[model samples]
Target: DLAAAPGVGVDRPRSPQPLVTAAPRADLVIWAPPDVAAALRPRAEDFGRTRGVSVTVESVSDVRSALQDVTAPESGPDVFLGPHTWLGEMEQQRVISRVTLSRNQQRRLAPKALAGARYDGQLWGVPYAIANLALVRNTDLAPQAPQTYEQLIANGRRLKAEGKVNRILLQSTGSTGDVYSGYPYLRAYGGGIFAKTPNGQYSPGRLVLDSPASLEGARRLAELGREGVIQPDVDNTNAVPLFGDRHGAYLVTGAWSVPVIQASGVPYAISPLPALPRGGKPVPLLDVDLFYVSATAQSPKLAQEFVRDCATRRDVQVRLARATGLPPALTAAYRDVAARDHHYAAWFDAGRDGDPVPSVPAMQAVWGPLGQAFADIVAGKDPQHSLTAAARQISSDLP
Candidate 1:
């Protein structure tokens, strides 16, 4: 069980039985982010035409907030798309229902992606795509991928010395700090938000941010800060453009930024972020995008069939990957698309090697304190002391 906090819901165990009820027939409606809606429209139309089931896909400005009225008959869509992070709270609120997939359907998607859809031992959605951060090198500047973080830093320094680029790495360390971007460094030094069970479930009680290895990771981060590697001013808004403009030799970003970089006409290559000299491999955070059925859906059967059958098809997954620029969660579709797009392949590879963001409600408490601690370390605060304080604050914040 996760602790309840203001603005954050607590995870509650629910009966595993599917939610099936008597209701009038309704057109299956889906609310998706603009990009996903655009991708899903044609396929949805095809499904409605062939199956004689009415389907509508709405492009929403805010995908995350679309679930606030999930139980409202007039406002709620049958299905909604969002990251797996929402599973904890939405499940707690009973706004989303469990999705039952056949054995074949389960086997069609990537294992990690399916794992992301499960919360408290029940499937909640159908994962559509996987997103993870990777190293994007400006081929014009770096020319080759560095095998390790040390070599990357060394090359960055060399490039910096020649007055060719102003920034070593174009990554966001925003005003409040970005734990998502800083996650690789933390993992490389053996620090993580929580311990995981043998089968890979996050154990909320095992908060490890203040452990010895984590403090060492923080120390290394502060060392990089003092050495002028991690800059204080660079943020999410500017990092992409600065890298596109050749202001930086390398960029640590996700696949979503690829189109902008391509539009800038900068030659780039994608690869996983390198390991540290004496630490474990740097594992980026994986965020799986899923289509969740609303618990109070008017067309529950249609929504489940569409997500489980139509949406997971190879052609549909391929089209979705094209539109979203994310690797398909479907294994065969990913292999098909990855064969043609090296960039998407790199992202998929990174996601396979990365840690899925913990979907437990306790995770909400982690972002603020850990992010602030990272910012403080970058601002030259003592790593050990700062992390200790952060850990203490997070424990207090936990329910």
Candidate 2:
């Protein structure tokens, strides 16, 4: 009936300007985890000055739970500052939209940082910080950092032999060894969960983690258990406490474990994961911290403009790094901190040695089955058979 109204047409509306300008400038609410709330709260004024939109900083108790219903504008954030790994799940829910960047803008960020949130060729989140796994050695127990995996185990063996420590090396992992923590060893043998094309795009359809090369990596892990360097059950439960209590001379983990290590009163040094003895390099897991825009944002345009302009500003990014001591993702911001801090510089270099974790939804398949296989390997199962079974399980799980 309205199609026949006077001065109205079936194919056209009376005015197109409203549709073009539907998203007006409005206040913004940024939801952030407690640790980084102070880092982002100060930007409220900056966003106001630049985008003419006041910002309210809300403390998120649980980052994942807080973002679960992001399609509801009244409750969800205009923007969210959290881990980049959430991008896949969020995008699948259609709760977040890709924040397109220009060529020059893309150049400002580190490639891996961008890759963590990038999926299907779209940069869905604007990255701010990077955290990756590396070798954290207790300088008190081991005066020098290990230059190779061989060196690391050698030191641990001597310490255990000397009755100075119970475990040679300590790494926090799940029962089967955490894939994230064990990735460096797996990568050392030219194996990983996903294969990449020449251009470095992940072809999830072509998984490489269960390939023959991966079997070699699995054998190495099994060797650790057979040599008594680490017991089959020693991995997940006690690594953090053991490392903190001076029971572990060498630890393979990320910055997230640094504070507990420090509080233990142990002298430590941060270094990249060791190079493989056979001309290979261990690649650690690199996780990015990102700022995401909600699709349900009332001021969608202003939210994007704030993320693009104010949030990525060098000053803001630098302050974020200083507050958290995490490496900044902005290339310029990282350079500034790397010049001033040795610890931060080591982490930056370590991340460069590793590849980004695939952000595809199917990446979920690589975890449980693969982790169980790695556990079985260390428990005296045949590495080749265990890995083969895990790969078959992964393939079956995928469409």
Task: Evaluate all candidate structures by whole-model CA lDDT and list the values in order.
Answer: 0.80, 0.73
Error at 122, model 2, angstroms: 1.2
Where model 1 places Cα greater than 4 Å from the true spot, the runs are 1-26, 69-71
Residue-by-residue lDDT tens digits, candidate 1, 1-399:
323322121111111322222244348888777777888989988988899877778777565544553345656788888788888888987878999899899998899899989998899999989888888998888888888878889999999999999888777776677887766777777788898889889899888888877776777788888888889788677888899889998998888888888999999998888877675577788888899998888888888988888888899989999988899999899988989988788888766778888888778888888887888888888988888888898888885
The clash tally of candidate 1 reads 0
Least well predicted 10-residue stretch by lDDT in candidate 1: 6-15
Candidate 2, poorest ten consecutive residues by summed lDDT? 1-10
Clashes of each: 0, 0
Q: Which candidate is the best by TM-score?
A: 1
lDDT by residue for model 2 over 138-210, one digit each (tens)?
8878888788878988888888888888888776544655666656767787988888888787898997877
Residue 232, model 1, lDDT: 77
